[model samples]
Target: MFTRIASALLVAGLLATTAPAAHAQTTAAKKAAAAKKATAAKKAAAARTAATKAAAAKAVAARAVTPKAPVAAPAPLTEAQASAGVKEALNKGIIKAVQFASEPDGFNLNDDIHIPTPPDLEIVKSTVGRLPGMGLVFTQLETQLNRAAEAAAPKAKDIFLNALANISITDALTLVTSGSTDAATQFLRRSTQSQLISAFHPDIEAAIDQVGAGRAYATVTDKYNKIPLMTPVNLSLADYTTQKAVDGLFILLANEEAKIRKNPAARTSDILKTVFGR
Candidate 1:
């Protein structure tokens, strides 16, 4: 009976020890499983963070590479506005030209338009230049010729403006957009050259008489005739001075036209700004 009791006690002790070891092994296995699950959760969180950052970076790069909208172009110019603008420019040019030409010595001092000895009468001038005391007389005639031109210059403003008013610019936009500063001036020249020549002749003839060009011509011719064997010259001082005066006025007008057309400050009008401000 005692042996049986001893064996039963030993068995109870062994069961108690084995039960604690088994419980420890089960707890260790549960801790390992929890650590693996935490590691997986951490990896999943890092992947999501990396994916979110990459998407944000991609969006930023796309924004950086995006193109801007294009700018709108200006409205096209109308013919009416173009024509009026050219006319305005012409008017301004004409006024300035006339103002310049009407001033004292405007023709006399200006080498560009100062009347030259008639191209046909170079021999007459040469003969006169060689003759004694005729140099001074010829100088006087030259001065008087310029004075006649000056006298006729004031009449040009009215004539030019009248012609400009009557004439039409067939293609004002073509002229204005031609990018040539002298386009408007050329238009004025082509339209009014004939009328200007016609209108200037009578006034020029009168200016010649008024400025004593006849007396100067007589002095020159009389002195030339005295040179003997020189062909007797028959010339109209009125005709020469008139054509020259018209030509000079147009030259001045061209300068003024360029000023008004190309220089912004010379625009001096709202219409000009509207048309050329582009």
Candidate 2:
């Protein structure tokens, strides 16, 4: 009976030990499975993240490779406009010359410089002024005409300047490029002739009437016409006046041009600097 009891206790002890070993093995297997699943999930997440990053990088690269539209250039100024600029420069030169020429005594005192002389009657003025009762009247007329000319002279610049300002750059470009010495002058005459005639006519007619020198003028003109076969010679005072005004203006313009050519300061503005060039 005692032996039987001991064997039973030993069997119980063995069974208990075996059961603990089995529980430990099952726990270990469960832990390993969980670890594998977690690792797999982490790896999949990492792969997804890499793919997303690659896609983003590819999108950025594509954007960088895309080309932008080219910017357009500004349009150039037209020929007429450029010519107009040239005309403006020329007119400025004229203004400068006239201002320079007009001194205290001005045209009257400067007989050697015939620019101050009234239109088409220099001989008649000097001759008639020397005559009998005509002397004072002729001198008065001379003075009046000279005064009128000076007064009217300044107005020409305004008209000429306006014409020049309107002149197209294209006209200026063509004129300069054409290589004509008198191209600028010719252009001014063509553009402003009619306007100049209209502006100067009334003043000249009034001047002729003031001098009482009209009879003397008619006498001189008749004598010249009667000389030989001089046609009828119905010359308009307007023509003579316009011509004189234009001549004086041109003379002054040339002077101004000389200034620009010689003195650096005379090239006052930026346009002058560019046009004249250093």
Candidate 3:
């Protein structure tokens, strides 16, 4: 009976010890699993935050690269406005041109408009230039021809203004809308060329006589005629000077017209600023 009692006590003691050890192992395992789950959740949250930041950065970059829209063009002008503007431009241009051309050295110093030895008198110049003291005669004649043109330049202003005053509305509109910088000047030339020649001839002739250009030309021709086998050159100095002076006047007018058309500062009047500022 005693042996049976001792064996039962030993078996009970072993059961109690094993139960406590198993409970400790189970608690440890639950703590480790909870720590690993928390770590995994923190990693997922960090990844989400990084993704959101990358998406926001990409959006900002896209916005930075986009282009802005262009500005709209100015509105067009009315018919009356166009006509008035064109006439004003022409008027201003002619005034400046005449003033500039009438100034001293206007034609003489300007190679573009300076009258050269007449084509009709080239032979006379070439032959007579070889002679002593005769070269001065041709030089003096050339200078005097430019002087005549300069003297005749002032006569063009009245004629040009009259033409401007009489310019038809249709013509004015055509010039304004033609997209050409010198359209008005060209129109003035086409319409007033004949009138200009007629008006300038008398003044050019008188200027030539006054400036001694006629005498110098006479001297040159006399020398050429005296030379053996040279063709006698007889050109009307007034006619040639009138043509060249008119042409030079138109050139200056055209230059002024271009400036008014293309440059904002050249638009002197309110009408010109309104019409061409567009």
Candidate 4:
């Protein structure tokens, strides 16, 4: 009976000791689980924060690469302004051309526009030029022809003005903003070359007759024809001189027109300063 009592006491002591140890192990397990869960939650929050910061940085980078809107352009030129500007440019250029052409050396000295001896008179000129005293006679004929044309240049002003007055608003606009350096000259050329030719031909004939160029040409041709084996030539001196004279005037006009297109200082008129400067 004593042995049975001792064994029961020993069993009870072992059970109490084991129960406290089991409880301690269970509490330790619960604390480890809680700490691991908290660490996982912290890591998840850090990952979410990093992802949010990266997303924010990407948005900022996108904004930096975007282009800004452009500034607005100024208003268009009014129709009246365009018309006035075109007329003003044309009138200025034409006036300058007429004034220059009216000068003594206008066509005679300006080699670019100087009328050569009538091409038909080539053989006649060469033949006569060989004659001792007639060496400069052909050159004199060319000068006399140019002088006649110079005398006829002022007449173009009135004809050009008349033509400009006839130009429509659309035509005026086309000339003003055409971006062409020769716009004014080309416009005048189209409007006036043929008309000026007609107006100039009779005057050229009278002027050449008055200036004695016709006599000079006759002298040269007569002398050449008398020289054996040379063919006779008859060309319209009036036609050649008149065309060349008009061409010279337009060449000068084109120069003036270019100044308006390229040089701010050349835009002297109020309308020119306003329209082209902008």
Candidate 5:
């Protein structure tokens, strides 16, 4: 009976020890599971946060990529505005020098502008002296023709100013750069020829009548036309005045070009400032 009691006590002690070890292992497994759950929760939160940021960034980029509307163009210049621009260039001494130089005195005084009496007229002048009273008639008629041209000088300025007003800024720039002194004159002839012809025709006719150039021109033309087989040349005072007006304009424009190259006053306008200023 005592042996039996000893074995039973030993068995009870073994059971107590085994119970504590098993309890310790169970506690450790539970703690590990809880830790794994916490780690997963943290990872899931970080992934959500990263995804949200990516979506926000994508939205901002899309907004930035949107295109804006285009701007409108400016209006074109009006006729009045264009005219004013041309006139501004003219009002400055730039083109004025040309006008002054294109007058009767401008050409008559400058050896360059003279329309030489036809080489044939020299024979007429020499023969007139041998023919007594014919000398005075020839002299009077020649003098009168020249006087008529002098009388017509003032009209040229009027024609030039009118032509200048019509000059386009595009044409003006072309004239200022690549054009000769006669560029402006050529432009005027092309642009203002019809208008000037209209404006000067009546005035030229009246001047011819007043100067008595009509009779002299007719007599000379008649005498020349009567020469057998020669091209019947009927020269009119009006026609001469028209040709003179064109010649005078070029002479004046050349003078203007000279002034512009030398004088500061010629480049006084705003357009000139832009075009000519350094």
Candidate 6:
């Protein structure tokens, strides 16, 4: 019985040591499996990143090699076209200017072209204008002067058109290609100003008389002359009105020409667009 008990205790000690060794081996095997799975996942992620980079590079290369479509140049302008366009633009400007200047209160209300007291009458305005009731005479005269200008504005359209008709083809081409905004207007002014003054004087005189501007001027000047120690003021109302009226017309014409030259919307006709677009 004693020999059997000792053999049984030895068997229990062997089981305890062997059981711990078996547990350690199982834990080591599980750790090795987890490490291998982590390495496989890292390699898959690296491959996907590489594939995305390759796709972006390929797209950039494709775009770099592609050729874009070319743009077409504008058609060349002919001399005939330039001439016609210049005339058309001038005609449009002239018509609008005449219409604007001829309207009631056109010259009087427009600060840009409004005729003020004449330079010769400056002393009268400075001295006599300070007087009660005398100041109104100057104001009335100025209003009537502008009114006369408005009445005479329509007569200038036919004369302006006639002058435009005589512009040579070379001159028209020069005007079209001059690169100056008011080149056409300047040309008209230089060529037609003298003729306009001569043709417009009688009309302006009649208009001034009809509008009572002449009487207003006489009344103002008469009052100024009656003032003690004042020099007699003498100005030809007809001459002054004619010159100022022509100047006002040119001012309006230049503005219109500038619009046609610089603004695309002002190019109303095909001829204007074709010539001025360039």
Provide TM-scores for the models.
0.70, 0.50, 0.76, 0.72, 0.51, 0.78
Q: Candidate 4 overall Cα lDDT vs. reference? A: 0.86
Model 1, clash count?
A: 0
Give the clashing pairs for model 5: 98-252
lDDT of 3 by residue, 60-158 (tens): 999999886888876767778888999899988898899989999899998778888789988777888889988898899999999999988998889
Compose the digit string of candidate 1's lDDT tens values, residues 1-278.
99999999999999998999999999999999999999999999999999999999999999999997898987888888888887888888898888888888998898877786677667777867777877777787788888888887888888888877755655677777878878777877888877877888888888777887788778888777777677788898888888898899889888887777668898889988777777
What TM-score does model 2 achieve against the real structure?
Answer: 0.50
Q: In candidate 1, which residue pairs clash?
A: none
Error of model 1, residue 58, in angstroms: 20
lDDT of each: 0.82, 0.63, 0.90, 0.86, 0.60, 0.90
Please report how far candidate 4 places residue 133 from its true position, in Å: 1.4
Q: Which ten residues in a row have the lowest lDDT in candidate 1?
A: 163-172
Worst 10 residues of 6 by lDDT: 68-77
Candidate 6 lDDT tens digits, 176-201? 98978999999999989998899888
Best by TM-score: 6
- List candidate 6 stretches off by more than 4 Å: 1-72
User: Lowest summed-lDDT stretch of 10 residues in model 5?
Assistant: 85-94
On the 0 to 100 scale, the lDDT of residue 221 in model 2 is: 55
Report the CA-based lDDT of candidate 5 relative to the real structure. Answer: 0.60
The residue ranges of model 1 lying beyond 4 angstroms of the native Cα positions read: 1-71
Model 5 CA deviation exceeding 4 Å by range? 1-110, 115-130, 133-136, 156-159, 218-233, 262-274
Give residue 232's error in model 6 in angstroms: 1.4
